[model samples]
Target: MILKIGKLFIAAVIFTGISALAVSAFAASGPALFRSEGCIACHTIDGHGGSVGPNLSHIGSQRSLSWIKTQIVTPGAHFASGSTVTINGKSYMAIMPNHKNMPASDVNTIAQYLESLK
Candidate 1:
């Protein structure tokens, strides 16, 4: 009976270790991909980053994968039209560069990573 219990414990430990390794690999990839894509320049996450774009500290919780994917693929479409900022008492059109041309797969990866942030 003890031998059977020992075997079960060993299996559980091995499973846990494998799961940990997988999570570590995923975590590493997310940040690495984020840097490679230049997202760090415009967005602040976890209370650190630039101020040019909206805070993404909890974007994962707010946006679904499909919504996130669309934003990445067509950045301009997701944002509201027309510039709300006033310059010289005149409304200036908000300018957000389009990312529609970026590869869908890469954007999907980014979206997945962002969704997992929380």
Candidate 2:
């Protein structure tokens, strides 16, 4: 009976490990989704991506997750008191087209991922 109990405990541990692995797998894919959505074209996270916008290496520390999500869904909601996104030696409005077509849930995922970028 002791041996059987030990086997059951081992199985439980294995099952928990598998579950944790699955969760991490999903978490790992969050950044992939950001890339797939073309965010890389304008933003750089993790020291790789684009220079059209500011490098978001520490965005998680600078911006709240909720603010990031809202900004993703409706960009230009707030702009700095000075300056704007410069393009090709010219100043342009800080308006980011809202990807309204994207599902809110996906946007939320992206926001969470960006929030974790730091």
Cα lDDT of candidate 1 equals 0.72
Residue 15 shift from truth in candidate 1, angstroms: 25
**Residue pairs with backbone overlap in model 1:** 83-94
Question: In model 2, which range of ten residues has the least summed lDDT?
Answer: 79-88
lDDT of 2 at 16: 100
Instruction: Please give the TM-score that candidate 2 achieves against the real structure.
Output: 0.63
Q: What would the per-residue lDDT of candidate 1 be over residues 4-108, giving only the tens digit for each residue? A: 999999999999999999977765365666677777777778876765566677778878999888777666566565556542344535454567776676777
Writing each residue's lDDT as its tens digit, candidate 2 over 54-97 gives 67777788789999887777675665423476544556457466
Off by over 4 Å in 2: 1-28, 80-93
Best by TM-score: 2
lDDT for every model? 0.72, 0.76
